[model samples]
Target chain A: MSAPIIAIDAMGGDYGPHCIVPACISFLAEHPSLQLVLVGQAPLLEDLIARSSIPALDRQRLHIHHASEVVAMDDRPSQALRGKPDSSMRIALELVRDGKAQACVSAGNTGALMALSRYLLKTLPGIDRPAMVTAVPTQTGSCHLLDLGANVDCSAEHLYQFAIMGAVAAEALGKVRPRVALLNVGTEDIKGNQQVKLAANLLQAASGVNFIGYIEGDGLYRGLADVVVCDGFVGNILLKSSEGLAAMISARLEALFASSLPARAVGLVAMPLLRRLRTELTPAQHNGASFLGLQGIVVKSHGSAGEEGFRSALRRAMIEVRENLPQRLHGRLEHLL
Target chain B: MSAPIIAIDAMGGDYGPHCIVPACISFLAEHPSLQLVLVGQAPLLEDLIARSSIPALDRQRLHIHHASEVVAMDDRPSQALRGKPDSSMRIALELVRDGKAQACVSAGNTGALMALSRYLLKTLPGIDRPAMVTAVPTQTGSCHLLDLGANVDCSAEHLYQFAIMGAVAAEALGKVRPRVALLNVGTEDIKGNQQVKLAANLLQAASGVNFIGYIEGDGLYRGLADVVVCDGFVGNILLKSSEGLAAMISARLEALFASSLPARAVGLVAMPLLRRLRTELTPAQHNGASFLGLQGIVVKSHGSAGEEGFRSALRRAMIEVRENLPQRLHGRLEHLL
Candidate 1:
């Protein structure tokens, strides 16, 4: 296979290029056949690259694509679309659309990224709208949760589409015959809102997918299903709430560790294992969310993602590129929807 | 002042009277001025109570109000309401309705309990529906979250009422002019669905509530607001998902502790503090959820809650009864709505 080139929105996220540049150098060193087109201001990108200890050979593979504007974190999706044509986020996505890169990765405004990607690449066949899907850590492994905030108001058909796209994305990420379940308040058939109930009905009769019954939010962490689907409104809240709870627990543990001398000794011995466990389940590790059902690949890093997390988003984009996730989703929709 | 009498659904939860009977005995012993009516099948409840070591004085405070039927976990709300008129849950609510008891507490089917509560007690004036409200531990203290699963499809008006009711409940629980906020995907005024945005407008103009702007799920755990309001669908999933994540984290920590001798030694020393933290944050400690906006106090215990959890539910009822929460909500609605 030919070397793959991935587009990066270096000016995105809270930290911007200072976080993205080092991640690019490290990631480029690891993947010998990979190239990155870092999209941002030329002078700033060049200055950061100059200060980095990147090898001469790896530097040859790293390129800078200048974009004039940067999307603010709070930019409205509509405003970001119509107003900022030369934005780093928009240009990175444009790179993928123009076939300059196989995939686009950004730790930018999610609404802006989604809006720009859909406007640039459009949706695949049999897909109503692209959905945001990300893996959340569970006991057995991690499960993919979709519509993480892309579509706040979704219909039954939209949910059914999310399930189908989620299953394809899960399989592409290496789960075989993934069990797909609708996220609901209760597991019973009679539970959930009209959208979920109707979506469940559609999923039950669909082909080319393993449709499990409704799984409650508790079941999500129990690893009861490989792919859990919900409307973006609910899914967004679920993901954020988990992050909040994790932060609270970590803070409490830290406070407890600092309370006394013997407690400090125990905390010192115990924290490594706890921290490792946290990286496995919490937002710090599972960093990227894919905008599934788009005509091309787009991975969204958490807006506050660090260097390692931005690289994780890059890794996700590379995997989806190699897997040709959009094509796989397109094929599955032909049979399932 | 007269002693407060509470009606209990003795055969409600998974363990039935085994869990309730002990909790009842312990609670009765603690409150010398309190009385309890344990409603269930006469023989089973009687047998369980007899097996327990109860003081003669405390036993006099406990009475058996036998009801032939039990509301099973899987029973539909409508079916439980219509077919199980003689159920322990139903009779317990009836006791509160007839003013024979100051409040009612149950660990029965939530749907059935909500249905029964609404039917028996009715909603407070100006309140269209009753909502389930629970206190979740936050970094600062604990915040009240409402509409756990009663009204899945809530309108802007319903959410406005929830805010009024939530504020009243928070104040009744002791917070002075408790800050109320609508739970949404983003905190921006332009963000979230029609209901939340519209509800925000209503809350912004409304009196008697210290209405804060929109709060995201992460803000929930940060103790940013005293009361967070959402539709039942979202609230149910949020609470259950939090439980699931806590369980997952605890399990991972336990596995790490058991992996080696050195780890086990550290675990033993660390576990006491960890367990205390878990109890503070997890459902294991916060056991009861109040059915807010009802004309009378009806605290719903977790069906799987243990002896201590049931007792926590009982204590919640005691506090609500002392405060006369329903009357406070009624008065608040008159001023605000």
Candidate 2:
């Protein structure tokens, strides 16, 4: 009858505890069956929480664990692994590893997080690498896209493993019998390189995956499949390109509205519609990138996430913990592999 | 001096001459000196042109060069090359090969076009493989993105060639000393695969290229650099994913606006702004994908492009011919390599 505890790296984001503490307080208010362990510099987090309007009952559920070091945004992954042993990001993952928390969430350097999590908790059985999976907003719903910069030069075997993990993760996230597709330039059988062709054959022959041949980049956002799989290089590029295009469009819209009085008036009238569009497309709404295939559940918040975005990541971690995502993925992968 | 004659693959796209003939007529009306050789089944093109509003003066500049066959969208590239010798796509390129036309434009199968063009016009000296370059709409203007799906498995040398050609193409397209950046997962020098890293080194050392370090996908539409370079696989995925995401967002906006009467009223008031946004972001506005590093100008339009989109491709080919893009690329690449 004990509530699940989630560990938060309070000093990991750009604004550190200022963003994380408020987010944790907000998250705690909503989830009654959850407790939080804030991992960071105790004094700084304490100061932040004191300034915030957290209720006494919610405050009682919040615990702070001190860590001396912090991972810099520009720190090399290898350097962070070797140097920052007492870092907030490392401490949060350690809580998950030691069973002190059901899940761990951090708004830290993505490369550092991946390296340290793999080094600490290690990959699940039959998994050589832990691919990063995130929910990309699509037409029908969101599609689970994997290898968003884990293994850049992935082999056919690596892609096959990703397909297995992605399928399990998608199914665990409530997609029944997730339709999986390999990402390529074209949807044809002979579109990409030798590796992709080999991966396609392996995926087609593999058990437990609803392999739907090849899907192109444009098809990915159309919600053509539940799971869109690719090597980290291509996946990362696709994800980032989408982000860049979205940002550019947003900037253009702002300029257009500011250009003339008529445009500004129309924008004001369409403010509610515009807000919905912004909320629906913004990356912050889908903030967490799950480090799938790890032995324990660890979610990565964007390093520059604000309060609401960090809360979105924390909420994602709670959902993963409730679903027992890592366990589900491990079980499915074992049978499938 | 005679007007530059351009070859057109009239029976190549989804609607074949129905799309191509109308586009040709519109383009001729704009540029009086421009001549077009419509290569396809002469009867189909003639019938379509006869039905179109082609004035007697403009009709004199239009000529239909007959071809016996059409290249199917799904035809295997190699099979199409050998089997469809008298194909419309082939005859159009042959006009350029024989120096009868200054450039060739097609809204046909991409792989077939690339294969036959490589076999016919050949690559510029020192360029191993031709890259498909296209102008992606950005905030400032448009960025020339290359290797958009010509070579799937690109080595460091291949990428280096692409970078050089892309830079040259950008400069020829009016960008002053085009700032070229290698597209990768992150902006860091050590972010991508071995090939990308090696290409980065090669680009940095090469002369005549304003080699900026690395740019992530999100930077592409920001106009951070005039030319963004990547292997064809990554480039193609980025291009298509952007297209897919843009389309999805447009559809979502329409649905949101049409959801309620109030929202529809706001949409009606904001129709002009929405129209402006659509004109700015739609793929149809940036329809042509230029085949760079070839010995002559060859532009590929979308297979299902409408009359306006096909006209965009023809205009692009004309621009390349006027800029002498291929010769400029050849000269620059020879020195850079």
Q: List, in order, the clash count of every candidate structure.
A: 0, 0
Q: Judged by lDDT against the true structure, how good is candidate 2?
A: 0.86
How high is the CA lDDT of each candidate model? 0.89, 0.86
lDDT of 2 by residue, A1-337 (tens): 3699999988886878887888899989998778999999999888888988889999999999999999998999988899889999999999999999988899888899999999989999999999998888898998989988888989999999999889888887889999999998888777889888999999888876899989998888889999999999998888878877877776776676677887677567565665566655656335678899898999988877788888889888888888898889888877878
Question: Candidate 2 at A170: error in angstroms?
Answer: 1.3
Off by over 4 Å in 1: none
* Per-residue accuracy of model 1 over A1-337 as CA lDDT, tens digit each: 5899999999998989999999999999999999999999999999999999999999999999999999999999998899998999999999999999999999989889998998999999888889998899998888999889889899999999999989888998999999999999898988988988999999998877799889988999999999999989999999999988988887788788778998898889887777766665555335688899999999988888888888898899899989988888888788766
Model 1: how far residue B287 lies from native, Å = 2.5
| Tens digits of lDDT, candidate 2, B76-149 | 99887999889999999999999999999999999999999999999988888989988888878888888888
What is the fnat score of candidate 1?
0.87
Q: Against the true structure, whose TM-score is highest?
A: 1
- Candidate with maximal DockQ: 1
Distance from true location, Cα of B31 in model 2, Å: 0.7
lDDT of 1 by residue, B1-337 (tens): 5899999999888888988899999999899999999999999888888888999989999999989999999999999989988999999999999999989999989999999999999998898999999999998998999889888899999999998888888888899889899999998877899988999999899876799899988999999999999999999999989988988888888888889998898889778777777666656335689899898999998888888889999999999999988988887788887
Model 1 steric clash pairs: none
Docking class of 2: high
